[model samples]
Target: MPIGPQPHGRRGTVEEPYTPLNLRLVLAAFGLVVCVGLSILLFRMGWTVPGWLLAGWAVVALVDIVVIQFRRRARARAEGGDHSLFE
Candidate 1:
């Protein structure tokens, strides 16, 4: 099928095989980097000895798990496998 702009003021997007998985992965990685950097800065400045780095790592890990699950479900649904994406 032709993947192009939709009519009206609606956002343009493909129906399938072109979900935002790649974009989500990129954003998640960027968030992880920012979290670690901020944490280090705060620690070095003596403003707080909080677990900034650790917190950032945790956020990245959590998001990774969620993204993986979402992609898996999408694939399963598209393939008409013996599983429901909503389930």
Candidate 2:
């Protein structure tokens, strides 16, 4: 089906802009990079309390981001496309 461009204005009661799936993907990528960079920095600082904490944070962040991204993509596919951010 041919989908047309969606208007980029607030449509709901809450004031906000429409964030497309592609833009979300880009943000997710940046988040992942930040997680990785932090993890590397922690590891480079040698094994310590803060290092362990950062490592745990990195794991949680990576998992959360990956799961969210996959769910979004899957939901988009299951429906018709990325027309709705609702999952």
Candidate 3:
């Protein structure tokens, strides 16, 4: 009774917004590029350990990009047409 807004107390019904897969793909791609570039720079600077770690992360980003691509293709097919990624 002392609050301006009352909590729903676990009975609140909230709908989650749809995730943007295209944006995820783009971000993953950007991450991969940055990780790879930084890894190379670190290696040239003789920071072997961090360089290897960044390289590993770059591989993970690459895999994520591939997985996102597959998901995008499946979603497009399920939607009955091949829509552009930006759409």
> Which candidate number has the best lDDT?
3
Tens-place lDDT per residue, model 3, 1-87, is 121111323223355334466788888999999999999999999999999999999999999887777767666665645444553
lDDT of 2 by residue, 1-87 (tens): 113333334343445333454556566667667766776777787756666676676677667566656645554565554454331
Cα TM-score per model:
0.44, 0.48, 0.73
Of the two candidates 2 and 3, the one with more favorable TM-score, higher being better, is 3
Cα RMSD of all models vs. native, in order, equals 9.8, 7.6, 10.8
True lDDT of residue 13, candidate 2 = 41
| Alpha carbon lDDT of each predicted model | 0.56, 0.57, 0.73
Residue 67 of candidate 2: its Cα lDDT? 61
Model 2: residues >4 Å from true position, as ranges? 1-29, 83-87
**What is the TM-score of candidate 1?**
0.44
**Clash numbers, per candidate:** 0, 0, 0
What are the runs in model 1 whose C-alpha is more than 4 Å off?
1-19, 49-62, 69-87
lDDT of 1 by residue, 1-87 (tens): 332222333334555344344455566667777777777777788756465655667587667857655765565565544532222
